[model samples]
Every structure is written in structure tokens, then in C-alpha cells.
Target chain A: MHNTLLTTHYPQLTTQQKNTMNKIQILVIGRDADILQAVVRLVNKNEHWNATGTSEDESAIELFHQHSYELVLLGGGIASDSELKLRKIFTLQNPDIKIIQHWGGGSGLLKNEIQSALENNEGGNFNIVDNPFN
Target chain B: MANTVLHKADTRGDANHGWLHSKHTFSFANYYNPERMHFGVLRVLNDDTVAGGKGFGTHPHDNMEIISIPLEGDLEHKDSMGNVAVIKNGEIQVMSAGTGIQHSEYNKSNNSTVKFLQIWVFPNKKNVTPRYDQIPLNLEDRKNKLQQILSPNPDDAGVWIHQNAWFHIANFDKGITTEYQFKAKGNGLYVFNLKGDLTVDGQLLNTRDGFGIWDTDKVQITAETDAEFLLMEVPMAM
Candidate 1:
């Protein structure tokens, strides 16, 4: 299912073609240590995505400065004010970076959010089979 | 001859990694005790507490019957089979990881911790299609009596699994007595005291204590103090 989605969305990057490209780096920032650990574990399952996570805001910023993250997933554990501040900082550092507020709904939602974010950022309108929220 | 074994609450291996604290009743992850490897077909019993908005990530499993019951707060479950749901207190979730499946669980609350029980039972039928089921429990039915929570028959009372076993839960008042009989031949009951005090077949048990009884048709439980417990009746020999 995941492979099919990627193949459909990115015609230029076929499943076979993906192996030659570098994996997209994802940064997961959260206040809860367990959630950070879980997100990293989930993200690493995908061959096209590499994940790094941190529970501290300062450490997350430091990691962001050191690495180019294609996406940033903010956990629900972060307060609204802090989330907004982080978003501002992220945008200033890399305006094209996709930052999503993750409700920690489940793996399915997380995958969808990542896909949609990537799709929108890349300006692709390829057909998506099921829009679960709709 | 009836045989019984006691597993004290303190004997279980403990693992605390900041955000996740878990107690393993049997060998799991990094904690391995050869003497406590398994009890019959029951391979794992874990008492876990996850900090708010934290939980287990997507992991693969095959040919195992996994059961999760939240004691407090809610848990969000997602699987590669495309099942997404929230299981809260008074609810039971079961997953048959046949032929391999990946799933993840997370605490749904951001402010409160979620405590839950994760149990694994060896499936009698292997290489079948993976399945997921969650059953909501009625609190009133379990008051002072055993409430059937899981059973072998798919059409039987409570949620069903791919095994000839039964699970029951009960909350008792002080001085109340209840008797549980084996539902199948050659079955043993693993009694776990969750809270308060109870005396089972002349043996006293405190919170978190586990007792396995086999070769007996019935076992009597007398609550010395208001108590709550779970009983799992599974085949003595796998």
C-alpha cells in the first residue's frame, strides 16, 4: 500500500528509482520521550524516509541546524505557544520545509499527513484513491 | 493432581526507560528469565505505563494473539491492515498477527499517562489472515462476579481469539466469594490480582501477584478486601 502510494504520487521516482536517491530526512520534535521514540521507530520503517527525534526544544533546534530535514512532525505534547514559536523558527530557517502538527492519531494518519505534505510541497496533483477524512 | 505455581509481583522483570515503564511477567524484549519464559501457551504478560502522547511504534509480528486492555486513559491503534481505532478504559483490543503484520499503539491523551496490559498467546491456528477486534466492556456485569471478556469461539460470548481459551475479569467487594471452573479440558487458569486483597484456593494474593492453577476443575476466590482481578484459562499443554 505504501509503495503504491509513493509510486503513484511521484512518477519520476519509481519504486526502483527510489533506491538510487537519498532518503528524505524527517525530524520529530516532542516533549514526551516515549512519543519521540515511537515516531522515530515508525518513520524508520519506510525505506525512503530517515527519522531523528528529540524531546528537548533546544536539542531539536540544534539537530535542525546540523541536518537538512525534509519534514518536521510536531507532537501533540508540545504546548500551542511553543509549537507556534517552533514553526516560526522552522520557517525562518527553511521556508520550504513542511511542518505538520501531529495529533498522534495513529500510523495511518501519520502516513497520510506525510504523503499529503510532500504532495503539496512538490505541487503534485496525482490521483489519491481514498481521502479518509473527507 | 492439582498443581499450582506462584509468581510474586516482585519477581517480574522491570524496565523503565523514562517515558515508558513496563513490568514483564515473562521474558520480553531485553528482559529474559529462562525459568519464567512462558506459562503454557501464554507467552507474554506485560504491565505498561506510557507517558502522555507516547506509545509503541510500528512493529512486525507473526502467529501471535496480542491482546491490549487499557486500565486508564485511551490508546490509539493502527495496523498495516488499515485498521485505526481508539480503545479506552473498559475496552479490550485483540490482534491476530497471522502471516505477519505491522502495528503501532499510542497514548491518546497529552496530559495524563495511560496504563494498560499487553498479553500474548500462541495461536492454535497458524498462517491465517490477520484480524483485529475491540470489545467494549460493561462495568456492571463484572461486579462481584466473573465477566467473560475473551473466548475461543468466534461466535461465543465476549471477544473471540484463535485459541481454545477464555478470559474473565471481576471486581469484588470485601468478603465476597466467586468460583471459576475450567471451560475446557486440560486447561489451567492463570489468576492475576490487579488490586486489593484476595485468597484463592487457600492461598493469599496481593496486588500484581500471579498464580497458575492446573489439574483442577474449579478454583474458589474469596476477597479479603475489595479486590479486582483477571483470570485467563488456557490449555495446560501447547
Candidate 2:
């Protein structure tokens, strides 16, 4: 989410952020646009997507309540805290929202999807990758 | 500056069909440029903008890691690998078009234009028989955070790319500071700020400003104002 106090003076600053922000009103908290756009673009096609409105992850929760969004996307990788802080906020602020995360070089989600697909569907895209050079 | 083989991509032929406008970052069929082949194993960087109701017809790919990141609007993806996904902003989908695969991308929205970034990376090992995986990210986690979108490991939170690199997205509040540690062994990060203002190690990065820092252990970013940035931590060389 953006700074609430300072952003009032620069209207164009908001406009510039809008250029890269998605249809969802977002606050790129700790992550950047690539991840935000990556998620917003992945979820819904709502014309109102504007995740750039909030510059801090903490502030975006209020924005979500003020309007509404199909999903809330975040970057993974907890910085040594063992437990996650944002996960709890998402659970409390918008329990109805879906939270998607991937960290440790992006390993958790991919692994879960692979395991689930394998368990549920036998013939899926999972396969042993062969050497291209060979 | 971290060591990067800058292949000032030579122009490749493109297709503009009113609805879909795609420009290949590297040489493609009917538009070949050997020198513009690829930067290391980074094969294709296609910038595509699909009209409100237009998109690409069915196409085929093989033995490559295909990643689609929507810059704006929604991208409807249907593949022979039995996957139909829509990837948009802040989201990423990985397709191991191994052996051979057929797929098509279209704009699902009726009135909104769909802008997306499609990238191709060579696999560590090829011929993986084809696969598809998509993940939608949350903005809250990324608030002042660097969220990982793709990597080689399947267990990572976001999508998976076949290369030995990691893609991270983080939007920083003005005067907000953050740090990024290397995600892979012997790998470094390349920072590209698509929008807003950011300073890394006292170096200012504006729109499209790029920074390649390697051999170091971590990267620290402090935004002068509300900013959106991308981080690609890959091998220092091919």
C-alpha cells in the first residue's frame, strides 16, 4: 500500500502507479508489480483492478473492504520468522478471499499442485524432464 | 554491474491481427535472426497485447519452459496438455511444453484489453513430456514484500520455471526499504523497475532501469516513492 499521508499531494503519483496496477486495487506491501500483476491478471478480469492504490500490504486490507476484489495475491518467503504474519491478516480481514503463495525459490505451491494433480488425475502434465543437450 | 550477456535483441517479424499484437524478443519462424536467437537460455520474451475480444489461435511448442505473465487484462490459455488457464497481473503460469504440445491464448474479457508478457526459458533437462501449472498470487503478501513467482523446484509457492533462476515481484512504498537474499546456489539477482522510483545501494532506478548485481549474498532495495519492481535472479552466465 502507498503512504496515506504523503500520497495526497501528488495526484499524478497515483496515476503513474495506475499505469502498472491491475484491475484490482492493490498495495504491493513487500512484493513488486510483477507479482501483483501476475496474480491480479491471473485471477479476475475486473476493470476495477487497481492494486497500485495501496503501497503497503497492511493498508490494502482497508482498501479491499472499501471496494472488493476476487482474490488477494502475495509473495511467499517469510524472513526467518518461522510463522507468517500476513497470512493471519488475510484470514482475519477477508476470510472470504483466496490467498495464493509460493516461496523458497517458489517451491511450495508447485509441489502441492503436482502432488494433488498426481493423486487426483493419473494422466497429467507431470513427467521426467530429459536433457536438451543430449 | 553483474555479468549479463546483453543481446540488444534484433527486431524479429511480428504479427498484428487487429486484436492481437505480438512482438518476439528473439527470432521466430519466418523471422529468423541467429544473433537474436537468445540471451543464454532465455529464448523468447514476447510482448503481447490482445484486443478486447481477440487473441492467438492454436499453436504448438516443445521442449521448452513457457511462462506467461499478464501485464494487464486477462489471458485465456488452452493447451493440448489438458490445461485451460487464465493468467493475469501478479500471477504466473508455467508450462513445460516438453516433447510436443499445442496451445492457444486469447483475451477472455469482452471489453477490457489484455496485456501480457510471455517468456521462454530452456529447460535444465528437456523432453519432459509436457505439463502445465498456474498459481494466482495475493497482493497482501507482496505489500512491501518480494514474492517469488517461479523457480526450478516444484515445491515452491508460486509457479515453476525450468531454469536455475527465480522471478520475484515486489511493490514498495515510498521510503520503504527491503532486502532480498539469493534463492539459488551460485545465482545472482537482476533488478528491473518497471515503474515508480527505487534506489539500490544508493543507485537510483527509474522506469525500465535495470541493475545486475552478482557474487554478492543479498540485495537491499529502498523505494523513494510508491514503486513496482521485478527481480530475476538467474545464472550469471549461460
Candidate 3:
């Protein structure tokens, strides 16, 4: 698997302001190729968000350690135990990062989840709740 | 005259990842065939069986009409729209990924496999607010006759999708004959035999066989044996 990154930049800003305007990074994890591609395309549509998806646990973990991601979207392809372990690792590394589990649905629900997560991050609130469906 | 094409069941791409077994009628995921990319507006037709207690995790879709028809066992569905339901054998589910949506499906049973057909069609109306609907299958009305299960009309008899396509399912006894005319002039029909044997437009089809026809008014189907099938009519010009 080659590393493919879709990056966005904003011009006409000061050096520090330009850094602040860099697109929000989102890490998506799932085993389904179609789902991964959809996530990347959906995240890139906003231009304010950049997403990278990988099915491999090691790859996702490595990516998390290498970059500062504001959120992580976990796909249903992973087991419950694995999801928890990954969530623990992600929060431990960055307390501000928001993680949400996605069961299959439509894009509207996905955007809502992302919005909720972003709001939680902005509020500086860190609370993990058990997903009733899980 | 109708332009006809036969897409045999065996020629479909197969993906088996232990917990899930899927067969794709058109290009999907890692399976890409340029010539077999789509059947007009019909983008994907995947026959899938998920292992008990396992399923697809949350996924995103937009600008597509997605449908699910369970053939065996039960499938648990959850979406970002706050819909959580179980679709069984006698039901049909549709989701319009208009602006965007996220959802997941898992087999609810721990001891049995859940088999279902997943379909995707390009929406004629784009970027509308996403919606979801599931309807109960009327088993009594479909015996030896075509039963309309999905259509573009919101007020129609069946569930509505965001595309100008129609879907019908039927269970025919042996020696039964039926005719299905296209609902729209420029639409093409994809006939998929779910079980038994049948003759469609003078072509014999066995279990899982698929036949696509366009440029015609109607197609004749004669059941050589007890047969169950799904018929989908979608626009060819989209």
C-alpha cells in the first residue's frame, strides 16, 4: 500500500495563521476498501478536512503517532474489543482527539457524528461513553 | 428491438473475507472491470452473506440510492439518522444518501448466517436531505405474480428511492408465465433469478443467473420450475 495524502492549504495568511488554517486531519480505520475510499472522498469534500484511511491496525496506529489528528472515525469492520483498545490508545496519546464509531448508514449521519465530535473537542470535554449498540 | 446481455452468476467477482462472503454483479471495491462497470444507473448489485454476530462497520455514502433486501435470517441496521432496526426475510430497506449519511449492518443471529442483496443506484435528484425507509414484504400478493417492491414514486405501492428505477420480486410456480413491461420508455431491466429455473425473453436462467435487457417494451418470463426472482428497471440514459 502506497502512502497517499490529500492536503489543503490556505494562502494570504501570515506564517502562523497559515499553519492554523491547515485542514483538520481525520484518521479513518476500516477493513472495507469501498468504505475507506468513501470516507476519504467525504472528508476531502469540505476542503477544511483531510482524511486518510487504512485497514491495518499497525498502519492506523503508526499514522496516529506520526501526525496530529483532531478526530478518528472507526468503522464497524473492527471487533468491539479492538475498538476499545484503539480508542484507549488514541485518547492516551492525545486527550483532545475525538473518536466515534460508525456503523453503516448514510453520509448525513456521518457528518453529524463529525460535527458532534468537533463540538466536544472545542469544549475541551473528554468523556467516553459505552455505545448502547455495542 | 431489445438489446440483451446475459451476466452469468459465475462470472461475478467474488470476495470472501472469512466473516463475510460477497459476490458483485458490477465493479465494486477492489473489483474493477471497465466493461462491466455498471448497468446504466444501477451501480452495484452485491449478494452478501454475513457471519453471525459480525457485520459492516459504520460507512459513508452520498448521492446514491442504497437498498437492502434480506433473503435469510435477520440483519441489524443502525444509522446516523438514529434509526436502529432489524430487517428480516419479509422486508425491504432503502436509504437515500442525498447530502450524506453513515450506517452499519450486522447479522443479529449468533448461530446462523444472514444473506442479503445490497444494491446502489445513482439518484436522479441529488443533494436532497437523506432519508430512510423499510417496508414489510407482502408475501400473499406475490405468489406466481410480480409484486412491486420499490419505485421512484413516493406515493407508489412500495418503498420509494431517489432514483427513477423500479424493483419487483416474484415467486412463481412451475409452468407459470408472466409478462413485465417497462414502466418508463428509456429504462432497461435487469432480471436476477434468486432460485430455481426460469425462461426470460426466450433465455433460460438458473439460480443466481442475471439477464439485462434494454430498448424493449416488455419481457416474457416462464417458470420451468418453482422460481424466485427480482426485476429492476433503471434508466439507460443517466
Candidate 4:
């Protein structure tokens, strides 16, 4: 049933490709809807990357459990208490998941942060370039 | 039988960056191994050597329990918390980066290298007020016996962090044997052989080897030579 669902949804992907297919999934949580959506869009612009944004803690937790997210981006405007609780919950569920606190930064810096984190996890060199997206 | 995992010294990831050379016993910066990401709540174990007058620049960390044990030379530390200090051999340092903190460390000497162990453990609490502590250790106290160095209680022997973990170090003569009992029911123990040969739960380990065991209350360790090692007891579940 799972294979059938995958084939139906992704008809162009061969069995070998499907078996090796791995997308970088990110969960973006913030209090501001506009910035959250913008961040999601920016992340989606990267190839093989997918992001889902939510403004509510409950919804974020639900989405987290529903998807196998490798990273969580905690955007600005979240209360310290909420951030703490969310971090605890997320870590409890996935001990290896990387949680990044995203303060106010331009798209270039944001992208670099995400890239650095992913590369760091994959044992690659972490290099921060100045405004590559610009 | 106790569950166990072994990591030989040569299998560790090595990085050489001119001024610094480091070996990662587990996944660390530029040394990711999916299967070796961590052993329970015990995250990072880095054996590092810094060239004289050179060290890590200012960097930020948050929500981690960072501990350092200097083996040789002197390491000068400066942090945003307005604390500056030098830690040498026979000392341990710990920083609880609760909310966030920035710190830097450099070798204090101009001609001698500084060797140390940098370890990171997952804190049980979040958003804790950041704090730092370091203490000099009595080297003679660890001869042929375990000397507690770090624990969850600040009032205890060594520095404390925001985690349910205990760390101990010992130097033993050949033919000496000892048994270590777990502090907490669900906690596991990671044994790191600093020098010389040893056997833990019947597994032979040489210098720089790492052994992790759990699901048992106690284990026996025997020194095959005059040996020094560290024992880290941490929760098996996060």
C-alpha cells in the first residue's frame, strides 16, 4: 500500500531513485504569519528541500509528528516559555534533530545558517559566505 | 549480558586545521556519522590539541552542557559573562549554555601545545540561566580509585551541569581491578581509555578506545598497565 501510494503520487520516480530519495524537510515555527510564510518560501526555493510553516505551537507539534523533519527553525517573536517547551518536545521525539533559533536576518544570512547546519550534520565543511543569495 | 558498543581509537574522525588538530569520538563539526551521532544523552567527545598561542575564536553555543578537561599546558578562557580564567592540567571546566553564551579559548603558552578533552552532554532543562564553573583537581586522589569530577549537583565534588550525569577519572596500577555501579537506574556508562591498556566487562581496550555499556547495574574494569581513564555516566534516554 505504501509503495502504491508513492508510485501514484510520484510516477516519474523509479524504484531505485525512490529507494534513495531523501528530501531535507524543515519545520518553521513563528508568531508572525507573514515572516513564517516568507521563510517557508525561501527554503522551498532550494532544490530537494521542503518546508512547512506554522504559527501555533499545537499545530507545529502536530506537523512535526506527522512528518519526518530533520530540522526545526524557531523564528523570532516566540515567547521564551514557548520556545523552551517546543525544544523539549521536539528533542524528546527526535534526539538527533537539529533545532536552530532564527533571529532577524536577511534571506542570505538565513540561507547560510540553514546550509551551515545541514552541512555540519552531514560532516561537510561549514563555510559561511557573505550574502550568496543576493 | 549487558548491551555494549566499542569504538577503537583509529576509527575516530580526525581533522587537522593548522592551529588545531582534533579527533571526534562521535559526530561533531565536519565529522558526521549517522550511526555515531551520539550515545544516549552523551553527545560529543573530542580529543583536541591546540598549537601554542592559538585557539578557538569567540563562538556561540546554547542549551548545551560543555565540559573540558585539560591534560597538558594551559588554556586561557574568556566569555561574554565577563569571566576570564586559565585552566591547566589537573583541572576541569564546565559551561552551561542555557539560553545562550559566547566564549573563546586559547593556549596560554607561546611554545608548548595544549591537549584536552572536550565533551558535550544534552541538558535535561531548557532556557536555564547560563553559568560557568571550573575547579582544580587533586591528582593524587585519583590514584587507583575513581575521583568524581562532574555531577548534576553543584554542591558535589566537581562542577555541575543541568543534566543528570556523573563523570569520574582514575589512574590505576597494573593488576588493579574495580567495579562501577550505575548512579541512576536508566543511565548508561561510557568508558574512555585515556592512556595504557585496560579491560571493561571483559573487553580489551587500548589507549584512546571508547566503550559504552548499559542495561546492567555494574561492570568490572581491570587495568592491564598503569592506566588512566574517564567514566561518563549519563541517562540512556533523552
Candidate 5:
């Protein structure tokens, strides 16, 4: 009854709004909460992309299973073991999923990396930045 | 229908960087083919020939299983883990960059090039610890039969990685035939022809060609001539 009531009360969505709802879902995994939030904000700047951020491996896995993510961005600061586990889990669930390792660069490099990964019609881990910190 | 894909020798991506001449069977650095990214968890298959006094500098990799099989000459390897070694034509080397590791490789000879295969496989387990292993293989064992070079089990035979995969190399005389059974139920097999002509199932492959097959229990391989090849069986779901 509650589900039916909520559904009946839902407002009609316009065609443009419905189209905007088809944003590509992405999962951002990092160890630092601040950086994770910042990366998520950068990812959300794209009109056609939506991102969820997590600072823990467990939460990342939970969110991954809860949503149909097309891409996963692994930010710096994640432990090597955690990064490997996340990669294994994500790939096992969706073999076609694209994963990119996000090293620190400004928002420009971040956007370029995300856009390139999404636009490239290939599947595999892409480590674009090679020691930007250096 | 059974799943199958083929890559002829000439169709592979070629990169001639003077000292380093390489051919990529799958998508690799500066060579991105969406349809040829990977077969199962086999990420990279690079046929590399490094000139004398040239090699890869110290670089870092994590959460990957990197394996190298020398085809000619000797490759000198030095890593941050304090492991310094040389892998020759009859030897294989594997590096488990679990957490993170920096390593460098160079051709040990000053007058000759070192030819080798650089393969990358996605590991099943996460960061355990970095490791390095290399072992000399008996070429006689592969005569007219498959010689195991790599596997998941540490005690089985050859070196081990953190994945449920098996690698074997064989040298068959003309008209030799064999049947290979899948070690795992949901695994796929990638065949790389090193020399001469061969046929897998019903597909013909020439030197330096690659063939991938899945969704089957076994495959029949027949050598059209004196041939050498590598068989890599990897999981399809991961």
C-alpha cells in the first residue's frame, strides 16, 4: 500500500528531464574522504555522468552491487590490497566495465581522463597519469 | 556456437621504437583496439625484442601478474625488492606486483638483441605482497608435448601467480596432434603460434598468430609442420 501510494503521488517527469535521468553511473573509490568527495564533485560536473564516492572497500563493494555502474575511478591513497580486491570484485560482476586509475592532476586532467575512458569503446584498466606528482 | 576469435600475425599492432620492436596482440600502450582489449583476464600479450644495451627503466606496477618468457639472448632484471637476476631463452620470470613494486629490465648483451614475450594477467587476489620468481625450463620436456610453464598452484609445476590460470609451451613435429582439456569449467584458452603452422579445432593459425576460444570443454590442436606455440587457459568470468 505504501509503495502504491508513493507511486500514485509521484509527479510526471518532462521528456527532457527523463533524458537527463539517463546519466552514466560511476563509482569513485579512494582512501581519503576529502579527495574522494572532491573527485566525486569533479565527476558530477559532467552533465551526462553521475558518481558515487566511497572511502572504504566494503562500502565501495556495497554501492557497486547496489547500482549499475558503467565505470569505476580508483583515486590515489587506496591501499594496494584494497585496490586489487576492488578491481577483482568489480570485473567479476561486469566484465565490460571500464576502470581508470586517477592520479592527482587538476580538474582538467580528471575530466579528460573520465571523458576519454567513457568515449573509448574498449574494456580494460586504464592508468592514464604516470606519476603526476613527480 | 562456440566462442572464438582470431588475430593474424600481420594484423597485430606494431611499434618499432628503434631499440624496442614490439607487437601487441591485444590493446596496449598507444595501441587501443576496443574489440581486442582482452580475452577473459588476459590483459596484455606483447612480443618484444629489445636491442642490446636497451631495456625498460625502473617503473612501478601494482595488483598485476607480469610474466616474461625470453625467446633469445638474456634479459637482466633488477627490482626494488633487492632481486637481481637474468632470464635466458630457456627460462621464465614472473613478478607479482601485489602492493607495489618498481623494477627495470635490460638486454644483457651488447651485440645481440633479446627477444621475449611480456604478458600481463589480472590477478584474482588483491595486495598480498610483492614477489619475484624465475626458473629454467627443460626444452626437451616440450618435444611433441605440452610443457607447463606457469600455473596457479605453487607446488604443481613451474612458477605461480595469483590467478586460476595455466600456461604451457609445446614444440611439435610435423603431423603431431593433441587434445587439451580445460582445467577449469568456465575457463577460456588462448593459443599463440610461435612458429610454423597449426590448427586449433577447425581454425588455421600461422606463425605469430593468436587464437582465443571459450564456452567449450576441450580443443583439438594439430600441427601442420614442425611448430611451437604457447597455450594459456584463463578464466572467462573474471
Candidate 6:
């Protein structure tokens, strides 16, 4: 994967000390071309998610490590497995940071695995998918 | 004087017809309050729950962006656009109600209660063809984190809205802090704590409580404990 990010450091946010910006900063990682394209289209509609960057480049890890973000989305296939990728995420990202790993097609945590882990991992906050939107 | 925005999550106009119970986040047509017309482009947020073997009959809408998020059960949807789909738990669905369209949704389960959220946003562009899209969010994406669920541009994953708003859902771990930045210029974030406790803009927000700040570009949110929250950033001078 080419390092498109190396040439461009996260744009130096204008130094103006204007009022605090309320946009939600996000970092998305994945290989699904359609999904990444969809994000570009969607961000055009939502003025709230100030999307910082979307990467299919294997350099997603370095990009995430070097920048400061509010949320990060790990698209499917970025890594081989879940546990290994998750560990890498926590190690480099801020302790209070947010991340979402979109398992591309199928493979990763099983349903039971997620259910069981939810209880302990969430620290008692359960908004577990209780409904569906169609 | 404008009417007060009747946005209390609990003190809402409700309709329960056995099969479903819906609470209007803001005033609806028949339940109108002049002041409650809207808070920016955030027109409607109806908290709906459907009973087993029951759901909404086919309905028609136009010139809006409709998003349905099932919080509890499964949702079976059929649209006049020849679209048949099911949005199960953890799924985020969006329909551009442009150029008018008709659709029906039902609870696909037999003995389970279905709870969901219906949020409406004003469109940036008018009269585009009606369209539909859905995405199944993964457990890892939302596990102990806030997921970007809605954006105006449709560039990232998840669903797209037609307006200058973004909706993010997250399940925060104990003592985790998250940050948010607005996409549009001159916009700000309004933090809504759905469950648990949260501190945004340095103020504590309990379940169902919301605090909004405008004229700012970015804000920080820290969870005192495990929590679920939604952040809405919209233009203030609209």
C-alpha cells in the first residue's frame, strides 16, 4: 500500500483561536472501495462529522498513531484477526479514544463471543442492539 | 413569542395503539406547539416501540431524510420502490424521502417487542430521487466506543442524511473520554446522553438529558462510567 499520508500531515488546523469547534473528528480504515466512497458521499450531508481521513492504505495504523482523533473506524480486512488488531489499536490510540472495527464480509467475533464480551467490556453500559431499522 | 421546544424525552406526546407506542421528541402536526417547530434542522425524533406480531402500516413521505434505527427487535420493510429489506439489531437504515415515496414496516418477530428510533433531518438539496440504504454495524465498531452513524456527505460508511447534521452512537467504557468535531463551519455539538452518565463541554449529563453549545467548532466528551450517547451537530443560525 502506498503511503499517501506521509506527504500530507493531517492538515494543520487553522491556528485561529475561534470558538471551540463542535464537529466530531473521525478516522475510518477499510478496504471496501464502495464503503469508503459511501463515506465521502455521506459526509457531504452531515456537517457534524468532520471526517479527518479515510484510508484503505495499509498505513492506517501509522496514520492513526500519528494523529489525534475523536473516533476511528477499522474497516474489514485491515488486519487478519480481531484480538490482534484490537490490541494494536489500544496500544497506540488514546486511552479515552473511540474506535469501530467494521468486519468487511464475515469473520471476526462470533455472535456469542460478542454477547458474552458485551457484559464485561462495556462496563455495564448496555445499548446492545435491541431493535432494527428498516 | 415562539412556542417552547417540547423536547423532553419523557414528557412527550404519545400514541399507543396496542401494537406500537410512539413518543414524539418534538411537536407533530396535530400535536403542534408553535415554538416547538424544531431545533435547527432536527425536525423529528420519535421513539417508537412495536409489539409482537404488529408494526406500522404502509406510509408515504416526501422531501425529507428518514433514518430508522432498531434498538431492540427486528424490522421488515417493503417500499413502493420495489425494495424489500430487513434491518435487524445493530443496523442503521436511511431513506431519502425525496420526490415522494411509500413504504411499510413491520416487526418480523413473533413474541418479541421491537423498539427503535426514527430521526428526521432537513435536506440540503431538494427533490433528488427517493433512495434507500442500510448498513449492519459490527460489534467491534460499537464496543466501548462511539460509532459514526450519520453524516451529510455519504462519503464514509454507515448511512447518509440530507442535512448538516451528524449522529454518532457509542457505548463508552468506564472512564473513557471521546472527542468530537463539527463538519460544517459555524456548527456546534449538542450532547444527548441516552443511558448512563456523561460529561461533555465540562457539564454532567444524566440519562435523557441534553446540553447544546453553538458558535464553537469542537468539543470533548468523557464518560464517567459506561454509557451510550448521541451527538447532534447542526447549524445554529439556521
TM-score of chain B alone in model 2:
0.82
lDDT ranking from best candidate downward:
5, 4, 3, 1, 6, 2
lDDT of 4: 0.79
Which candidate has the highest DockQ of all?
5
lDDT of 3 at B21: 95
The segments of candidate 5 whose C-alpha lies over 4 angstroms from its true place after superposition are A1-72, A75-116, A120-122, A125-134
Q: What would the per-residue lDDT of candidate 3 be over residues B45-144, giving only the tens digit for each residue?
A: 9999999999998877655788999999999999989999999998999998765677889999998999999998877664568899999988987899
Q: In candidate 4, how many Å is residue A86 off?
A: 7.7
Weakest 10 consecutive residues of candidate 1 chain B by summed lDDT: B29-38
* DockQ of candidate 4 against the true complex: 0.06
Please, what is the TM-score per model?
0.65, 0.56, 0.68, 0.72, 0.72, 0.59
Interface RMSD of 3: 14.4
Compose the digit string of candidate 6's lDDT tens values, residues B1-238. Answer: 1111213456666767688788765555234334443456665666789998788666555546788988888999998789999888789899986655668899999899889887776566545678999998885786677688888777975778777778888888878986777788866566667788888767777776656676666777888878888777765543
- Backbone clashes per model, in order? 0, 71, 18, 0, 1, 50
Off-target runs (Cα >4 Å) in candidate 4 are A1-71, A75-134
Query: Mind giving the per-residue lDDT tens digits that candidate 5 earns over B126-160?
Result: 55588999999999999999999999999988899
lDDT tens digits, residues B50-93, model 2?
A: 89877876655545677887889888999876788777887888
> Number of clashing pairs, model 2?
71
lDDT digits (tens) for residues A19-40 of candidate 5: 6459888888765454566667
Runs off by more than 4 Å, candidate 2:
A1-134, B4-17, B22-39, B201-203
Better of 3 and 5 by DockQ: 5
Q: What pairs collide in candidate 5?
A: A81-B127
Per-residue accuracy of model 4 over B1-238 as CA lDDT, tens digit each: 6899999999998989989999989766556566675687787899999999999877655556889999999999999899999999999999987656778899999899999999988777655777999999999999999999999987999899888999999999999999999999999999999999999999999999999999999989999999999999999886
| List of chain B TM-scores, one per candidate | 0.98, 0.82, 0.99, 0.99, 0.99, 0.89
- Of 2 and 4, the candidate ahead on DockQ is 4
Best by lDDT: 5
